[model samples]
Structures are given as C-alpha cells and as structure tokens.
Target: MQQVKAGGLPAVSTNLDAPKTRLWGERRFRKAAGSALLLCALLLLVSLPFALIGPSVERLVVLVLINVAAVVGLNIYTGNSGILTVGHVGFFAVGAYTTALLTTPPEIKADSLRHLPAFLANSNMGLGESLLIVAVISLVFGVLTGLPLSRLRETSAIVSTFGLLVIVNFVLKGATNITNGTKGIYGVPELVNLPTAYIFVFATIAVAFAYKVSRLGLQLRAFQDNEVAATSSAINPNRRLLEAWALSAVVLGLCGALFAHVIGAFQPHDFYLTLTFELIAMLVVGGKRSISGAVIGTLLITALVEIVKPIESGGGIAGISFPPIWGLTQILLSLMILVVMYKAPAGIMGSRELSLSMFKRPRLSESTIDVASLRAVESRSERPAATLATNAIGIDFGGVRALNDVSIKVETGKIVGLIGPNGAGKTTLINNLTGVHQPTRGQVILDGQEIVGWPSSRIARAGLGRTFQNIRLFSEMTVLENVVSSALARGHLATGVESYALSLLEHFDLAKLADTKSSALPYGAQRRLEITRALALEPRFLLLDEPAAGMNPKETASLIEAILSIREKFALGILIVEHDLHLIMRLCDEVYVLNKGEMIASGSAEKVQNDPKVIEAYLGSQEVRAARRKKTT
Candidate 1:
C-alpha cells in the first residue's frame, strides 16, 4: 500500500487494501448473496402451493406475481421519495399498449388501430424487442412527468401525479387510431406464463432491493425525512427523485408488458383506477419501504381478494347461499387499508428489510478507529483558507424586516459566535447564509465568489455545511447511515466511505450505536450526529445553528471540546448561532451580537458582554439595566 502524509497525522494508505477495505467488501458480498438466496427461497415457498394446486390456482399465482412486480416498482419511487404517486399506473398502461401494438400481428393492428401511424400499424416485433421499446418510451414519459412532479411536495405533488393519470387515461380513450380508444388493442401475444411471470418478479425484486440500499436511494430517503437537512448535506432532492421516478416507470412498464402477454387482450380500463388502487393498496399494506414488504403485501391482499371475490360473485360459503354483494371486495379492501393505516402506518416491514439477520442475533462488535481512513479524509480537507461572508444582507417577510444590514464573516480556521435573544433574527441570518431563504438584498460571497440565490445543495457542495437549531437527522435511518449518506452525497468513494463514516462516529463516541436508528438516539446524541453528518461534507466553513441549545452542562462542555477539536483538526471556519453564553465565551474568537435584526455589537466576547445595547436587549429597558448595573457596582 502506498502511503502519503497528511499534516501532522500519520501516513494514510491510498491503496485499495487500506483499513479493512477487503473485509468490508467481503461482508457486503456475503450480505448480498444471503439476501439473494433468501429471495429465491421466498419465491419458491410462495410458488409451492400454487404448483400443487389446480391450474386455476396456478393462474392466480401468476397474476399475483405480476401485481407484486408492479407494486415493487411503485415502491422504488413512492417509498423512498416519500412522494405518493397516483400516476404510475399511467406508465403501466403505456407499457401494455406499446407492447400490445408492437407485438400484435400486423393484420390485427391494421383492423383495430386503423388510425395508428404506418410504423406502428405494420410493426410485428417479438416480445423482447417490444419490451425494450416499451422501456425506452416509459423512460421518456417518466422523465417528462418527473421533471414537474419532483419540484412539488406533499399534497401538491400527489395531486399533480393524479392529474398525469387523468391526462393519460383521457389520451388513451381519445386517441382511437393509436390506442384503439376505449375498446383497446387486442390479439397481443401470450408470451408470459407462470415461469415467465416469476422471472420478471425476481428481476423487479432485485432492482427494488438494490435501489433501496444504494447511495442514491439513501439520499432520497434522507430528503424524505428532512428536506432542509438533506439539502444542506449536499443531496439534490429533485435529481434523486427524478432518478427513482424514471426507474420505477421502467419497472412498471415491464410489469405492464408482462400483464398484456398474460391476458392476451385488454382495454384501457384494465390499467386505470381499478388497477391503480389495487397496486397501491398492496404496497401500502405490505410495507412500502422494503422489497420484502411489497411481496408480502401483494400476496396477502391477493389472498384476501381471492377469498372475498367468491362472495362478491354470489358463490356460497359452507353451502350457505346469499345474495351477491356488488363491490363487496372493494369495500373490504378499503376497510383493510383504513385499519392498516391506523394500526401500522409504516406498513408491515416499515423501513426494515427481511434478511438472514432477522432469524439470528446480530453480533455486535466495537468499531476500531481506522487511522488510515481518517488520515485520508484529513488529507482531502487540507486546502487554502477561504472566507464565507455576507455583505449587508437584508431579508423581508411582507412588511416585516427579519434582518437588515446583517454582515458577518467567517475565516477558514476561526470560531465566530452569533448571539441574540428570542426573535432577534439570529436564526434568520443563518438561514440566509445557508440558502434556506434568499435575502431581499446583499451578497453572500464564498471564497470571493458571489453565491447569493444558489440552492442549498449547491452551497453545500461548494464547501459550506450546517446543522439546524431543531435536530433534523434522518430519523428513519441508522446513525451510521445518516453520516454515510452525507459523505456519499459529497461524492466519497463507496469503498472507503464506511471506514470514513466509522471514524467520524468514533470521534463523536457514536460508533457503538452505529447500527441504531437515529430517532432512537437521545437528544444529545442526535445533536452530535448532526455535527458528524455535516463534518462528513469536509466543508471549509460550517454554520452551526444553536448546537448547544438543549445540551446539559456536561454535554455542552463535551460539545465545546468536540467543536474545538474539529476546528484544529480540519482547519475549519465555524460560525455558531448559540444562546449558550458560556459556550460563546469559552469557544469564540470573536462575537457579533444582534438585537432586533440589526448588529448591535461586534468585538471580543467580554466587550460584547459589557455593551449597553446588548445588555438592554437581553434585560429590557435602559432604566432596568442601569438599576441592575448600579446595584452590582
């Protein structure tokens, strides 16, 4: 292994073998192999009963597997992005129609799709060629829809996607030449069967699972948990959401192709609201976050539907005859969804995967500090000093000025303190600096480049990192994942990232709880983890908003030590917005005090402490301050 020195730290190995890299690879491979095996076993277990049962049961299994494939695709986007999509079935319809038009005999297309263009009407492609074409078309649609959808959040995004579905449904019904209108295209080749459906199910499961564990998915999930925090850590929410959206579109398209081949004929209504609701219910009930959940939920819902479907058709149970109940299955399914939502909002698997570890006790081991990896990170941080400064920044909320003429500068290796009482606009100033809010006027210069109006992700990538006053950890993720996601967002090499994250966790004494979910951590630990996550960005300047807010005396003292150590080790410029005067007095090289959105005092800590304006702002009224000062003297 080649070694390179980093400042006063020991030499870091730049070779692949440095710091348990090989061991990590082996563990990762084992886990992946184990998961793959488990999936195969599950497929076999599910197929066993259907295989032994009559052909009728076998057909139902095939349909269930296909539904599972479609729902898994939906989960890839909706589950990770936390953006519920009502339009995915539109992509499914696209796949079904595209494949149907392509693979259908040219004669059939000529009669049914008389208005279709010559190319599609004459096309008589095989299943493979049809599917490839479907994938490309689905990708185009995914990108087009995702561009607008990714920019929205919550109800707006959801409603926008539903609009997409309505538009697609309308297009399908109106475009008679292309889609055969409401009658739909027929004579699609029956190329998918039990084994064929199983193949696609396996592929879908693998893809969804891979995405769930990939860095991009981690960043998306982080954004889902806390948008401001993720963006501050350099995660581009739109890009991640778009990627997942496109991928899921392709998967859903393939599932539609499989469905077309299975049914051999279909109408536009086949892929409309009925199918959309069924797939969504399957995903929600199973657990939207896990591939295992998708499969489990599909199977459970399919069984329920099968059992209830007989009664809906007027079939007697136990030889007891009853009147047919129209929409009985739909009513029951709706009730089941309501119960699941109220009882288990996260679904069956929540954010967890079904793995071999679930069947066995996890072996806990102390994480050893990887010195070489730590040094590698330190080497990356070594750079010329840069300044992050705001020049006469002003912010307005309607007629109210939140901040006016606020200017602050932080250098590469100094700790600057920003202090103010409640509603003094301290946090607002930090917000402008971090790109959470654009200032009405003034410039933010980073290393001499004007960066006002830049996105938070861009600001973070430009080497500025920050923490929120209220903790914003990816609560659903593990402590280690929270840090690793930030590192990955900053483009850290995947091979070395785990070791680097472990080193940071060790620095904060959080390595032992690395596997624990961040939400499970105590308040102080969550605060430290936020700092650790920001440090993973390897930023030149860090903006910490109230890091000492809720820490007890001991935690605050430890936080001071950690902050000081970080500044010395990484040569970082730290701007801390804190109400904790003791921390400011102990750690700040310079203090800037704000009162009523304006800079009231700027000097050493002692000077600011004694400033009359600062005293009056905190204690209220000139008379009261003077009275207290006279009595003290």
Candidate 2:
C-alpha cells in the first residue's frame, strides 16, 4: 500500500499501481467489472427464452443480434467520434452478397445464377465453412470501403456516403453476371442457427465491451466532443475517426455476413437508402456511444416487431390480433429515436458503461478537511516582503514585441492594472503570458517554476488562470454547464465528479443564470460567467483580459470593486488588462503604458500619465506642447 499521487492526492507507487487495475485500484475495478459481467449474464439469461420459444420471436432475436453488431460498431463512428456516417450499410450489403456467393452450392448457384460470372459460378461450401469464409472476405471489403470514405468531413461526408450507397447499389445491380443482378441470390445454406447465432451475438458484445474501455474508444469520444481540446490532450481527430471508421466497417460486415447466411437471400433493393436510415435509427435509439445501449435498443425494436406480429389464433377467442400496419413499427421507432435525441442526447447512460447496479442505489461517503490542512495551504502565501514577486512579465509576439520587457511585482494582496490603447498589444502580451501563445523568447516564472512554452492547459494547472478577451463560453450549453465543462476539462471530464462549478458561480453572483443557455445571457452576465469559469480552476494568479470592455461606466465601477475584493479575499495576485483609464487609474497598484507593441513607461498612475513618451505616444503631443506653451504664455 505505497502512496499514489494524482489530482493532488498522494499517488501509489509503481508496484502498487499495477496494470491489473483500471481507473481505480485493482480491488475496486474487479468488484465493478465482476458486477458488470454478472449483470450481462443475467440479461442474457432473461432474454434467452424469448429468443428460443417461438419461431417469429427467435427470428427477430437473431436479427436483433445482427443489427446490434452493426449498431454497436456504428457507435465507434457516430457515438464516440461524433461523425455522421450513412453509407455503413453499403458494407453490410457487400458482406451479405459476398457470403451468399461464397456459401451457395454449385447446383443452386447454377439455377439461381445461370447468368453469373465464371469466377462466382461453381461456389459451394459447408455452413460453418461458408460463414468463416464470408467473415474474412467481408472484413477486406470493409477496409476498402472505410479507407476512401474517411477523407471527408461532416455534411460533405454525409452527402458523400449517399453517393457511395447509390453507386454501390447500381454496381451491384449491373453485376448480374457476378451478383445475380437485382433479381436476388438464393440458397445460402442457412447456417446461422440459434446456438451459433447467439455465440456470434455474444462475441460481438464482448468486442464492443472491450472497445469501450480501450484507448481507441477514449480517443474517439474525446475527438467527437472537442477536437481542439482533444488535440491538446494528444488525440488526433482524423486518425481516430478513420480508425473508428475501419473498425465499425469490420463489425458491420460481420453482421451483414450473418444476415445473409441466416436468410439465404439478397438483392440490391434490400439494402438501399431506407436500410441506411434504419441503421441510424437503431444507433440513436440505443444512445450513440454505448454498446449496451445499442444492444438494448436492438432487442427493444425486435421484441416490438414480434409483439405486433399477426396472431394466427393458436386461436383463443378473446380476440385476434393483427400484425402492425405498414411501416407502423418503423414510424414508432423513428419517433422514439427523435424523442431520445431531444430528451437526452447522451442516451441512457451517455457513454457510461453498463453494470448490474443499473437498478441499484449508489453508495457514497464524504471526508472532512482538517483545519490544519486549510491553514497549511493558506500559510504558503507569504506577506508582502516574503511573497514571490508576482507581476505581469513582458510578452512579445512575432515581429511586434508586445510587452517590451514590462514587469510587475505584487506585495501581499494587490490588484494591478495593465492599460494600453487598441493595437498596443495588450491581448498579445496576455496571450504569450497565459500560455495561449508561446513567447518568441521569454520566461514566465511562477513559484520558482519556469512555465514558458508549456501548453495553456498545463499552465492553467500550474496555478495561472485567465479569462478570454471574448467570452468563449460553450454557447450551446447552459450557464452552469459551461462552468461544469471547465471543471471536467480540468480533470479530463470524468463522470461522477462533483462540479463545484455552481458554487463558484454562486460566489460570483451568477447563480441565477445556472439553468439559462450561455448564448442567451446578457453582456454583463456573460462576463461574470467567464470569470466564474476561470475561478473554478482554483488559480493562485488570475489575469483579467479587458473585463470591462462592454460594460457601462456604472457597471465598470462595480466590476472594479469586485476585482479588488477578490484579491483581498483570496490573497490572490491579480492583473487587469483594460483600455478604460478611470478603472486603471483607480484599480492598478502600478500602471504600465504600452504604445504600438512597446512599453512607453511604467510607474504610479500619476507618474506614468506625466511621462513625455507616454503622453506623446498615447494622449497626443499637441496637448503636451499646448500645456508647455500655456506655461510660457
């Protein structure tokens, strides 16, 4: 039980943190994983009878497995990677058609495909052998499809897939000599029996389960949610998408082969645009990123179809039931998918893995922080004389030296102002200082740690936090969600972690906007929300970049008061970048003037205001000359 350190906690030693463990310790993961397996087994046991007892029910169950495999595979693309792919069924069609040709007997093929090509003409094989052959062959086809289709993005890709589906169908239709044309190929040796089919189904589930916990899956999910953030986190968007594309194609290809072997028939018309939509619906209904959601959704639709089947009246006369109307079930499924999309885009568990406790109450506990621990953290902050020289170090960008080696030193608790005219490079210096952009050449030392060239995220984690010049809140999200997202990013967006985001918002006086959409927020409120987001990271040094940019004079004054209070209360070193001179004069402990990307002067507000260069570059040389002329007159 050696100590482990992660997220401020003591991390365990290498020997104690063995590969046997996952996110948690080995014991916790084992318990959680064991419970998950038990739950899956229980569900399978419960669903087995429905799949075995009746002919129609059994048929639908088998179909469900096939669809589940496809849907689960598709999640790798749509669910985790957040990309839309509609041409997936093209691979399915290829697999189905391929399996039919490979497994069909010569005699049946001769009759069925008297017009078939010579290569496909005398195909014959045992059921097991044919399935094995189709699985391998379909996978090759999947790779071929994925390789070229992955080059496009979003809407272009969607439209591109439609083009592919049409082309594939037309090609299959024209390949009468090989694919038996659109008339259909038959006699596929129906090897997908109940036992064999379920084995394949379970195997597919295992693959999906394994994938969800794998590094690939994590990368896919990260890419889908935030491409920039994911890139910073070392996840490549295009590569991850293509990997998902290839993997999903392979799995769907397996499903296609199984379906072809099960029904012993196929045609170009069977897998067209309509089939593609159905596949998308299955994925959406089950929740995009979860394998269990896909499985559950598949089973639900399958069972619904069976329930709506026409009752030939094993005939008890309470009444006779009829099969659902044309496309009735599909319409219902479509409605269900639409509802889930609006109500909970993350699906039942979002990307959360399923476990036996799906129906159980969760257990929880809390620990108390000792007073000494709090004081230990506070004691680290020294008084004015002993404190680190906290200051806005000079930052320069390409060609224009934005900061001209400007520096500031903080004594105890103080608010500093960084005022410069537009185009004076205030934002540029902030960018370089905050790790958003690297300095052409300079260093940012914090608590004896040199943080130059570090990524913005790493710098932020190192106790330097800042707000953006523009309110870069996640607009589509709620206000609280915006802050919560920041918290999640701070720790890689783990589930079940409490977002003290709301607490920060409350402290900043924006709690009333928690449920409101960020984009809908007014200007003043938006600014506060942005500050609240940065504060959620618990930074030791906070940089405010033009916080009063859009505020009225009254609002600006109120914000200045709030800023001063924050410095005193947190004992935090603060720097403000603003063009509002009144706020700068009153707020900054010391003022630095920047003109055309160079520091003209630095001193107390009154002293810098009187400097000749500062007056010449900023206020107007004419005014200074007039004052001199007046003195002579």
The prediction achieving the highest TM-score against the true structure is 1
Question: Where does model 1 exceed 4 Å of error?
Answer: 1-19, 22-33, 359-382, 625-633
**TM-score of each model, in listed order:** 0.93, 0.60
lDDT of 1 at 351: 62
Q: What is the lDDT of candidate 1?
A: 0.84
Q: Model 2 over residues 55-170: C-alpha lDDT tens digits?
A: 87777667766776788778767776677788888878877887788778888888868876666777666666665666676567656666666657778878887887888899
Give a tens-digit lDDT track for model 1, residues 340-397.
9899999887766678576554343433434334433344346688999989999999
After superposition, which runs of candidate 2 have C-alpha atoms over 4 Å from their true positions?
Answer: 1-39, 115-119, 126-141, 147-151, 309-325, 358-633
Alpha-carbon shift of residue 476 in model 2 (angstroms): 16
* Residue pairs clashing, model 2: 3-11, 3-12, 4-10, 4-11, 4-12, 5-10, 5-11, 117-177, 176-181
Give the lDDT of residue 585 in candidate 1.
Answer: 97
State how far residue 89 of model 2 sits from its true place (Å). 1.3
